[model samples]
Target: MRVRLKICGAVLAASVLVGSALHASSKPRENVTNASDRDYPAAKLSTLRGKIAYSPGVHAHSLWVMSFDGSHRRQITHAGAHADFDPDWSPDGKNIVFRTERGRYDSNNTGAQGIFVVNTKTLRERQIQPRTGGLFPAWAPNGKRIAFTGLNPTCCGEVIVTSKPDGSDKRIVKLPTAAGECLAWSPDSTKLAFCGHQGDGNWAVWVMNADGSNPHQLTHPRAIEPAGTGGDSPSAWSPDGKQIIYWSWQPAGGELFVVNSDGSDAHQLTHWDGGDEATNWL
Candidate 1:
C-alpha cells in the first residue's frame, strides 16, 4: 500500500472554527475542455496586504486565513471529512486556489481529489475541473493560469498539468521523474518549482520552465539512518524571483532552506528540531 503524508507549514497563535460549506463536485472527466477562448475578468490587487492563508486540522483539514500578525482568524471551508489544503493565493488576493479530497484519501484514485477556488472575501467556492484530478494547485502570479499535479493513467505516475482558472485548455508536462508534487511558480511566472521523486530512490527539489521544458534538479538531500527517506519539497519563491524556499527532510527533522534560482548557494534558515516549511511568500 502506498501511504501519503501531508505536512502543512508553521503558523502561530491562531484559533480555528469549523462548519462552512464549499461547492463539491464529482463531475466527469469529459467536462474538461480543449478550448482556450474563455476569458476571465481582470482582477485588481487587493488592498488587504500581509495576510496568510493555510489549512490545518487534527480530524480533517479545512481552509483558514489570518492576518500576518496571526489575528483576524477565520475558517473558510468546513468540509467535515474532506481534506482541503495546498492553497495558492490569486494575484489579486481575492480568491484562493486549493485542492479538496472528495471522500477518502487515495493517491492513485483518479477523480478522488478536485481542484477548487474560494473567494477569500465572500467565502464563495467553486470546483476547477482537471482532466483526471488535481493536487497541489498553484495559481500563477500573473493570475492567468493554474498548475497542478495529477495521476497519469497510462504511465501510472504523476504528471504536471496546467489549465485556466475554469479548467479549460488543459496541457500536461511529463517530467523525467517517478512522481512530483508541491508545485510553485516563480514570481515572474516563467518557471515552476516542485518536489520530484527521483529515479535514484530519493526525492529532490526541481525547477523547470513554465511550459515544462528544461527540467533540472536543484537540491540533492541525503537520507539519514533513522529517518531513511530524505528529500526536498519546494514551497514558494521570493518576491523578487531571485531565491526559492523549501523544506529538507532529515532524521533530526525538517529544516527550511533558501537557494538561488539556479540551484546554487543553499543555506539553512532554521535549526528547530521540527518540521519547518514555507508554503507561501508575500
Candidate 2:
C-alpha cells in the first residue's frame, strides 16, 4: 500500500534516517535500477527467512531488510520519485512484494500505485499488478494466492482481494475498516484476520474465511482501558495458527496483544512505558 497509513497507535517510518551503516562484507550490486542473480553474489542472504523488509525514511521512503536484532541491514530500493512501503515476503523467501508510490493524491483522496515483487537475489523487480490504488500485500502461506488492499472506484473504501502470483483470477472479499487496510493469512492460508469498524465509532479485529465468508470479530475489547486502551491495527495469526497477535493503543502508548483465533483468552503480553507494534510474526 502506498499511503502513509495511520494507526490509532502506530509510528510511521515517514523520515529516512541518514548515516545508516551501509557496510556489507559484499555490497549489494551497484545497479540500483535493475539487477540479476549475479548482482547478488550472496545467495544465503536472500534465503534468510527471519529478516524483515520495512520503509523507514522521510521522502521516498525506501525498503530496508534487516535482522530482528538490527544487524545486517540492507537497503533494497533506491529512493525513486515516490516512496515504497508495506513489504511482504513470498513463502520461499526468495522475493519481496511491496508497493511504490505513483500519482499524486488528488480529489479522490487516495494515492495510486502498483504492486511489485523484487527478486531477493538479483534485486531485480517486476510488477504483479498494474499501478492501481493498492496497499498492503500479504502472501498466502500455501503459495497459491496473495491477499492485498485495493481501493473502490471512489478511491474510498478498501476491499480485500486475492489473485494468482501473476495477478490473474482476482477475487474480492468484503470487510471494512477505517484503518484496517490489511489482511493476514492464516498459517494454512484459509482465513484472514483484519480490523473492522463498529457503528458505535470504534474498531474491532475480525476474521473470515479466505473466500470472504464466515466473518466474525476476534477482539471485542473494551472501548476503554484505564485511560490507555484505545485501538488495534492489522493482526497476524501465530505460527501455530492458534492465536492472533496484534498491537493496540493505550493512554501510555501502544502495546502488543494476542488473542485466540476463536476470540477467547485475550492476553496482554507487555506493559512497556510507551507501547509496541507487531510488524510481523517472524
Candidate 1 on 125-222: residue-level lDDT in tens? 88775336667788888889999887876877778888888778888888878777778888888899988865544678899998889998999878
Q: Kindly list the per-residue Cα lDDT of model 2 for residues 1-282, writing each as its tens digit.
A: 122133222221101110012122122222222222111111111224756565654443677777544467788876476666667778888778777664332335564467777876788887776645566677888778988877654555567778887778988776645434556789899998876565333456788899878887777655753322355554466667887776566434656577889989887755545344434443
Candidate 1 total steric clashes: 0
Instruction: Tell me each candidate's RMSD, in Å, in order.
Output: 11.9, 9.3
Highest lDDT among the candidates is held by which one?
Answer: 1
lDDT of 2 at 19: 8
Superposition TM-score, candidate 2 onto the true structure: 0.73
Looking at model 2, residue 20 earns an lDDT score of 16
